[model samples]
Target: MQLNQRINAFVELGKLLKDLAENETIAQTILAKAEAENGWFTRENILFSLNNWAEALTQANLLQWMSKYNVELLPQESNEVKKVAIIMAGNIPLVGFHDFLSVLMTGNKVITKLSSNDKTLLPFIAAQLIEIEPRFKDYVAFTEGKLEHFDMVIATGSNNTARYFEYYFGKYPNIIRKNRNSVAILNGTETEAELKLLADDIFVYFGLGCRNVSKLYVPEGYNFEAFFKAMYHWKEIIHNHKYINNYDYNKAVYLMDSFPLLDNEFMLLKEDKGFSSPISVVFFEKYDSEESLKKEVSKHSENIQCIVSKIGIDNEIRFGETQFPKLWDYADGVDTVAFLLDS
Candidate 1:
């Protein structure tokens, strides 16, 4: 198919996913399965995750290929298609979904090894995709096997796990995921509405995903009051999740032992020298120049995923997204589109 045709196919797949969201019966069924099978993931979490994936894989994300690659797709020469192996991450909801879309949209077969933490959602979505368009089944496979058979690989995991992926999959062309996180830039200009949504960006998912904002680059003397006020309603939210609850439990003991924190009901604001990227914990820094901030951020660029603020002449940005990563935002900076096309 032509590149435009492939792009249209991706658009169709995105709509199919959105359709899945509005279909209440299927939604409930999938949510139940996702909860039962995913263990600890709630129904609302599953639905929200599915919806996020549906939104990200839109034409806007796919069009990124046109500009990024600077090439158009060629018509298929034969029915034979490449087979790509995807090693998915379970960090956030449906983290592997992007690879699935990359493989399917590129008219390639996907031999997927689902993350043990997220085994349920991908398989369920694959089954649904077959039902929505049976022909897609021929182009996909969910499996666990030796990596030699696949033409290329896209793997997501920790920096340590990435080293292992490199050792094993290095024989072939591959995309290996390493540790990464997102940061938020607050210039003290955000309105109430923006702060509210931005807080959701930081706290939602318990700051677990790579896209979760784990650090804030704020202007000097920026009032924490505005941020705290916008997030006041979520005060009761801190101790709700098991993971966050454990964090708070430990933090309380640490504080009793003389660990310092800027007190607030929803989250603890502590002065820090670094970023954790996947916790309610966030490191804060005040910057005078965009050059200096980007210089500081550049040192940890490999560890940062998205920047959730506007960019300026002195500012720089990377990773293509803030909290919501579309089909093109390959996890851990792996370029699945390039790998797929080359394979």
Candidate 2:
């Protein structure tokens, strides 16, 4: 397919997703399949993911994002179509969609080894794409067994699996992403509305996504009453059995160890210096000065995916925009498109 053809097909697919989000029957159908496949994919969350993608895949956004790259400079016809195998992560709904889109948009064939936890949604979307543009049928494939006959690979996994990926696929041109988490910086001046929005950053996807804020950096003697009050808006998430179960387990561990914690009935807050927090838990640390905080964040840059703040730190994502990454907002700060195009 030509580059324009590929871009148009995705834009159409996005429009279809938006239509599905508003169509009760089709939305229910997709939601039912997702729920049956993965219990964690509640209808609300599934639709949220779908709507976000719909917003992201618009023709305008597509054009604007691609405009930054010199698409015309890319090889019009490659001597050999390289196969880029994508090992997806299932931590959140459609977490690997960006990589899949990147590979296809770059004129490479994609062999997706879908994570079992999220195997249904992407393939369904891919079917829609193929239906819209038959040429896509020749470019996309899914795998169940071991990946083979691929020229390059892009893998997303935890820190442990990343080691295995490096040991195995190290010879191939690859982007092996390891575990990373986001954090928020609070200067005690945020309004209740801003803090409320920050709740979405922390609670969305039940905090399973890398963009979810797992930790907070606050000034010394920062008050918690306002933050907790704002977080109450998402209190209904406690009704989720899985989330409550995790809350119960982690809370019990902390209690048994006599570790001090602040609880809001649904989530637990602990004072610690850690980037990766358990589900239903968030860790916070006190910073003495802005310079020290920046130094600390920079020191742990490899473990951090994004920094959410209103203090105007360099590259800090806006208060609530952590999860809504633009197409060019490459994962792990690595340009997947550039990698694929160069390969």
Candidate 3:
């Protein structure tokens, strides 16, 4: 298919997912199809996150961006079509979807190895596309095998798993999706609504993804009330999940036994000396000037994604837009499509 033609199909594909989200009947049917097909998604946060991804893509202006960006990124020579083996990260909802969009936008065939934890969503999405237009099956492929014989590869995983990816996939020309974390910069000028949105960014997907706001850099006189109030909704979520409940319980015990943190009732605050975000942490620090913040952020450039906050800063993507990535928002900040097509 021609570039714009394929893009138009995907735009409709995105609209289908969006309508599924807004309409109870379609969304529930797809969810049921997914459950009948993939076993694990019947679980909690995984299910919530999967459903949320469909809502996010169309709701977040990504579909609109795709319609624009896909044709713009089309390869000059059709023979140079790059076939990419995509290893998705299941930690967050549809984490690998952006990379999928990138490959497809560049007129490449994607052979995706879905995260075992996320098998349900990707397959169902593929099924929907095929149902819309079977030709998408020609553009995308699924493989349970470890990626083999591809022009390039993209893999996302934990910090330690990233090392393994580098060792295995890096030998070939590839972009290794490493253990990255996003932090928020709060200037304390945020209004109540902004704080609430920022809280959604932090708590969504249970803060498992690279873009999740695992840390925050705050101004000296920051008011914590705004954040707590916005995030209060997730309290029931925290209690209902056994793993998060364990984390909260153990975190409280550790603080009591070992030491204390600059924290309150809703969330704990701590500082780490390095880049990777703690599994369930919300670090806070006082920033005096933009120069110092820039220096610190530059130091961790390899580990950061879109900074989520209302602060007037560079690279900030605003609260509640953390996972709402668009065509050019490449993972690890590497433009894979540009690398392939330009080369």
Best-matching candidate per lDDT: 2
- For residue 153, give model 1's deviation from the true position in Å: 1.1
Select the stronger candidate by TM-score from 1 and 2.
Answer: 2
Predictions in order: lDDT: 0.70, 0.91, 0.69
**Residue 302 in candidate 3 has what lDDT?**
80
After best superposition, candidate 2 residue 185: deviation in angstroms? 0.4
Model 3 misplacement above 4 A: 27-79, 221-223, 262-266, 274-280
Model 1 RMSD vs true structure: 3.4
Error of 1 at 196 (Å): 1.3
Error of 3 at 261 (Å): 2.7
State which candidate, 1 or 2, has the greater lDDT. Answer: 2
RMSD after CA superposition, every candidate: 3.4, 1.1, 3.7
Arrange candidates by lDDT, descending.
2, 1, 3
lDDT of 1 by residue, 186-264 (tens): 7887788777877777776666777777788887777899988876765656655665665677568658988676556
Off by over 4 Å in 1: 1-13, 56-80, 145-148, 311-321, 329-334
Worst 10 residues of 2 by lDDT: 72-81
Per-residue CA lDDT of candidate 3, range 70-112, in tens?
4555666767677888888876546677788777767788899
lDDT of 1: 0.70
Query: Between which residue pairs do clashes occur in model 3?
Result: none
Residue 179 lDDT (model 1): 73
